[model samples]
Target: MAYSHDSVADIRSESFPDYEARIEDAYIEGYDPASLGAPHSSLHTRKLWFGLGLILAALFGIGLSVWGAAAHIWGTGTQIDLSNRLLVLGLIEVAVTLTLGFVLIASSRKGYKEYRKRTGRVN
Candidate 1:
């Protein structure tokens, strides 16, 4: 193994056995478990935020669709027809949000579990 980044261009076949071990050690040492905790935890936070946002959006859309339907049914306020796409869109949003939220929560839990197992960090 060669330390040079451009080693691909310089094809010298003399093997340095220690280089591979040194590189692996350096890579492992770069991550401090005490400081970083678990790397996937950050990703879990992001996924949770995104999923909640989607859920909120879905709720808003559903509210809008219901309001429109109510207006049409009551025949008093601004009437949006039953054929309006808002109802369909709102239903789709709800399905998508629920699916994504479940997936994110499951994956994040698995990742955190794996990280804890690897680090042997029991808490």
Candidate 2:
């Protein structure tokens, strides 16, 4: 929504004074938008999309593992060695998939918090 000064609430929250350096200083001196679930001036559109893509990929990896297990694609065709083969493959899949998921979460959280701090916002 476009915020206009005619609105009373907008005057208080969306308000800024008529000065160039003052506005920049205000942002640099702690302009957090955590109430919006986002830190202000830290995340650009492209970076957010990239992070979202990483999370989507991790979820896809998990889904593929489930499909492989259910279809016995995780196992060798040999009748006798099928169980052991599936077990090994399943373990490998779990390890890699979980590791990727964890890394994605950690990296995103760290990056977000660091951005907030760097922009002078208190978490």
- Using Cα atoms with residue i matched to residue i, what is each candidate's TM-score against the true structure? 0.47, 0.38
Q: Write the per-residue lDDT of candidate 1 for residues 1-123, one digit (tens) a residue.
A: 659776455345555333433222333644544424544464537776776666666677677668656555565345445535666766676788778877766655776677567655542
Clashing pairs in 2: none
Tens digits of per-residue lDDT, candidate 2, 1-123, equal 998767656464457756534233544444545544553332444545465555556555565556556557555455543544554565566566566655655554665576556556555
Q: What is the C-alpha lDDT of each candidate?
A: 0.60, 0.54
Candidate 2 residue 106 C-alpha distance from true site, Å: 2.1
Candidate 1: misplaced stretches above 4 Å?
1-44, 76-84, 115-123
